[model samples]
Target: MDVTSQLEWHPLLRDPTGRRTVKPRTRGQTMVIDKGLGLHAFEDLLQTSAPYIDLLKIGFGTTPLYPTGLLKRKIELARQHQIAIMPGGTFLEVAVSRHTVPEYFDMIGLLGFTAIEVSDGTIEMERTVRNELIRLSREAGLTVYTEYGKKLWGSTIDAEELVETVLLDVQHGAALVTIEARESGAGVGIFDANGECRDEELLDIVGKLPEPDLLLWEAPQKQQQVHLLKTLGSGVNLGNISPNDIFSLESLRRGLRSDTFGLELSP
Candidate 1:
């Protein structure tokens, strides 16, 4: 199995400008959120774009829906490629709401998710509990990634609040902090009702934030993706990408797409 020798592998278009991230990277990380993928489809995604994808999130509560065998297969495949696969944070929230946080950890650890999202998107979690969950997930041997923002429509970010949360999450052992744009990427946290990026809001946060690479912007729309790529450079970490768009997004990052063609590669 000579990987990177396959005819399908293309040379990166940018010559000296080529600086795509390597595995176990902190920046330029692309996360593909899987929402109930069947075994065959999941296999196809990894076989094709495993090189570009750093994380695979079993979206929302779909974690409980897949058969145990299929779920284990996905985890093993992802790990084989050095990709982290975790159940969505909302499922953890569900467990917390139902007083099943310990049970959630038991199931998640046993089920083979190497990462966990400690988020409070729908429910208002207590700060102490949130920190405890972060610590517990790490204790249970999962890469803890926390998210900030509500899932409600038209919800916008408070720059100061976001900065504080980002600092605390990183300090508490979060690998990264995901900005909540939901799966739709509309009417929430920098996205308008039409799924457009709110430049004013995004710019303000970016300006105030200390370490931009620690933030993974959830830009599910192509237009939004292009805008972020152009504004923040290819090294910006992005999330909530659909399975089919993995190569497309990677193309955009490498300036191989029409939207990014002739755009100067980031140094």
Candidate 2:
């Protein structure tokens, strides 16, 4: 049974924005970062917020740390809820560093992951290698989400470089190019040190992109999420969200929160 079907509120009451897309949504997608929730917590999250979640990333290099049965069960529950589950890009980076790409893919396949994140956040990767990873993941039948920007603090976006990355990544079969904001949402990519959005930089990138929807902005902070939603409209894809903030983020997207109240209703 669909979990959301249990909600009995009228349409307007349930979604004041009236423009929020349902699950299997092309836009307004939410990607949550799972640091290490216990099995019961993970299942509870799916049962409650599955409809709002599009992607579930097992954060960092922790995928191999969970007991085999526990990890497999988490993946199974996410699949049952129609969420795309994958190990974090950093883990793939670890695999690349160790020359274990084949082993990495095999493990994820055996564990039933539905997607992959290709990123060079902490290491240097040649464009050829990056493209090959995307192709390999695609050939293996997993959805690919490529990420741009370094993970270092104070890192910022270079519009020209980002444009090239996005265009080439999509050409190589990546479903979306994520702009790295890390889990802190501060001093990285388009955000300033205080976690505020650098509006001009953001606009420059958005203006240059042929398809802005192909990019997912990682906004883990409430203020950052509101800023992006209000500026880019509610349909902008967001990532790196924390488990605790899932429903709150959804409320903000749908204008149920004060920060974005009557968002779509505004002129």
Candidate 3:
């Protein structure tokens, strides 16, 4: 370690209880959802929370809405900081629905995004289509993460269906399988209307998953994040996080905050 590498001071702070795996991390992944950040805020997010962020998804088909040059620069910036960035799964679904999968890949690859999300939350896709999308994205050298569950806010997890879907998804080459809690994290998937987690559903899935780390829970709210962190422990993979909450979530995960202090983590 080089002491001279130290530079600026923020303030006196509480160090997190346990050491987390640094970049190229396998567990405890955080995926920030970029809705429509301007160039300055995007740069600031990278400068501030790059260490805490593993993946960045430009949420909900907003990738194509960015001016091409700016989008490419954002992708480049995230990659420079060792963060994987990709468009929301729904965006790819739109391409798939429109029979533009090849063109979408060409556009995405040319723009230099490092990953892809394959999901059927909005559009009902056949199993073959889902697998092919996974294969196509991987063949194009993009990391593929598949998502399960409907977008309806009050839809609870169908235990057996969710389990089987995730198992098959991993078999078809999904790097991470996300439970569809939606951008609001309320009234959908594993959460209730007020964004509270369904404990029974959560336990069943986490307790049985072959590799729990491969499942990213979409928790977009503060209270939800705290609840999930306390419940699942430090090694959980969380997604759909608002860009502004990056450091706050990291603090909660590391027990640097009051909410999760003295919590125990799973191996």
Model 3 alpha-carbon miss at residue 257, Å: 0.7
lDDT of 3 by residue, 1-267 (tens): 787678644332444545566789888899999999989999998888899999999998988999999999999999999999999999998998899988999999999999999999889999999989989988999988899988966788877787788888889888899989988888999898888888998989887777777789999998888888777778789999998899888888777788887655652
Error of 2 at 128 (Å): 0.6
Q: Estimate the lDDT of model 2.
A: 0.94
Task: Give the worst 10-residue stretch by lDDT in candidate 1.
Answer: 8-17
Of 2 and 3, the candidate ahead on TM-score is 2
Worst 10 residues of 3 by lDDT: 8-17
Error of 2 at 79 (Å): 0.3
Candidate 2 — which residues are off by over 4 angstroms?
A: 1-7, 265-267
Model 2 root mean square deviation, Cα atoms: 2.7
Q: Write the per-residue lDDT of candidate 1 for residues 175-234, one digit (tens) a residue.
A: 899999999999999899999888888888888887888899998999989999898888
Ranking by TM-score: 2, 1, 3
Off by over 4 Å in 1: 1-16, 264-267
Looking at model 3, residue 65 earns an lDDT score of 94
The global C-alpha lDDT for each of the candidates, from Candidate 1 onward, is: 0.88, 0.94, 0.87
- Tell me the TM-score of each prediction against the true structure: 0.94, 0.96, 0.93
Q: Report backbone clashes per prediction.
A: 0, 0, 1
* Candidate 1 vs. true structure, TM-score: 0.94
